[model samples]
Target: MQGVEFAKDLIQKEIRGLELLFQSLDEDEKFNEALQVMSNVKGKVIVTAVGKSGHVGKKIAASLASTGTPSFFIHSTEGVHGDLGMVEQEDVVIMISNSGETLEVLNLLPTLKKIGVTTISITRDKESTLAQASDIALSYTYEEEADHLNLAPTTSSTICLVIGDALACALSNKKDFTKEDFHLYHPGGSLGRNLST
Candidate 1:
């Protein structure tokens, strides 16, 4: 019970800090632009990330595709090998990193730049190299003492996942995606029933 409470406390503190980060943005234009990008996507939304963010990216990509926007996730490390070919000129790339300086993600930047694909950065650092390179930067702010587990990525990753969900749902609303579209992406079992006509 104590452990669960501690974990819950950590999550709350970190998430609140993240909310503070978004609040400090002082501009919604970047977010709005991202919305427009998703809405205008001629191909698909390409999400890339490494480590923990990669797991969240996968879920986010799935959510985006299932909701309204067509999206898919590609591991950052694998991108250089061959996954970069998965992206189309018409697609928008969303890169996830807590520090906004992931090497694998950074290495792919040059190619993306050459290809002229719009890139969005979802990270805690607005001044990070990845953020600087991104066409749109959605920065996450964290409070001073929010136990980051050796300042690794525990809290930040959780907060980023929440933000990703918010983006997905907001765009879903904007696109007016029907539940029918959801079932098409999720043809599993009971949950599928909820989305089916």
Candidate 2:
């Protein structure tokens, strides 16, 4: 296949996968509960994940932090080492894992609970250990990836990113976050200039 056709196919496949994700969100009520939990967080939203999910988690944390919610990404492996101290009792943890069984993520759960921190999970498997252990779980199930093997995490990661955005937006709306508030956090980029004007 030509490069253009390949790109088009990938985009189309991702669109379909996102459509499925939207449908899943519509059917699940846990998303709203998760948002409510996050909206009430008295401290930062601690985002954690492993591998590709970790990269997505970082973006999610940045999105949340910029959009009126205080948040930061803590690599699961790093958390176990010493970064876990950054998490406080008032914070809410959002752990991301497509399978919901990432060892690093799961390992931090008990410690979080012991510290009196609330945990939220974004995962494809509601029954997975991470989901079951979380105070709230936002399901982000996807049918398949755009790649032929369906193992590159294209679709799943996209859905995860969207879910993170959804949560950030919801929290921002709840807080009545205005463009002025956004500008305070982002005062150097084009976005800052746009919001300032």
Candidate 3:
């Protein structure tokens, strides 16, 4: 029963954190700017991050790619190892970092700029180095973690995932993406079967 109670408490905390995220996004104009930048991207959307943020980045990239936007995820550490060639001048890079101070992510910024790539950052800290360097920064802030120790990344990572979905959905709507278009990319599942008919 104690474990069940703990689980319930964590769920409640995460819900409250999500509410805060929505409120903050409503007040931040950068959210719209970030969407605009993504919508207008002439080349692919390159997403990069390290650690757990990298996991979230991969999902974000996939969401964007399946929803009419061409996107791919690159590990920040790998970017320094010649994978940076995957990035092009016209591309827009979406870098994710909770602290906004990930060394590998920061290290790639100069080269991204040198190649004229626009950067959009998703981070909790508006004043973080990642946010400061970004052409557009989508800030998501929360007061507490769902985890009891507050050491885990439960809340912040959820915020990142939700924001990434918002970006993908917003871009899809802006581009008038339809079920038919989605089917073209996702043609191997129940969703594809539904879209076909």
Candidate 4:
């Protein structure tokens, strides 16, 4: 029962954070700016991150790609080696860092700036280095993580994922993405099977 109680408490905390995020989304002008940039992107959306955020970024990239946004995820470590070449001047890059100071992701900024691609960032603080350096910053406020220790990335990462989802959905709708378009990119899944008919 203690473990179950812990789970419930954690879940509730995260839910509360999400509710706050949803409310703030209506007031965040940067989100709208980010959406406009994404909608106008002529090249692919490149997502980069490190640690746990990197995992969430990969899911975000996949979601964007399948929903009519051309996108791909490149690990920050791999990006510096040669993968950064995949990014082009027309691309829009989205970087995620909880503290907005992750060196690996920050290091990519100089080259990205030189490439002259638009950059957006997801972080907890609008003033964070990652946010300040970005063309637009989509940020959130959370009291703490949803764990007993309040150190894990549960809440913050959830917000990042939600932000990514909001962007993907809004952009898809703005662009008038159709069921046929979704089916075109996702042809092997149960979703695709259903859309086929």
**Which residue pairs in candidate 4 have backbone atoms (N, alpha carbon, C) closer than 3 angstroms, thus clashing?**
none
List model 4 lDDT by residue over 109-143, tens digit each.
99999999999999988899999999999888898
Selected candidate, larger TM-score, 1 vs 3 = 3
Q: How do the residues 1-197 of candidate 2 rate in per-residue lDDT, one tens digit apiece?
A: 66999889888888987898888877889988888888888888999999999999999999999999989999999999999999999999999999998999999987898999989899999999988998888876666788877889898898899999888998899999998898999998788888878
TM-score per model over all chains: 0.89, 0.96, 0.96, 0.97
What is each predicted model's overall lDDT from 0 to 1? 0.84, 0.90, 0.91, 0.93
Ranking, lDDT, top scorer first: 4, 3, 2, 1
Q: Which whole-number lDDT from 0 to 100 does residue 98 have in model 2?
A: 94
Least accurate stretch of 10 residues (summed lDDT) in model 4? 1-10
* Model 1 TM-score, 2 decimals: 0.89
Return the clash pairs for model 3, or none.
none
Off by over 4 Å in 2: none
Stronger candidate by lDDT (1 vs 4): 4
Strongest candidate by lDDT: 4
**Lowest summed-lDDT stretch of 10 residues in model 1?**
143-152
Q: Which runs in model 4 stand beyond 4 Å of their true positions? A: none
List, residue by residue over 1-197, the lDDT tens digit for candidate 3: 36999999988888888999888876889888888888888999999999989999999999999999999999999999999999999899999999999999999998998999999998889899999999988887788888988978898889899999999999999999998899999998898888888
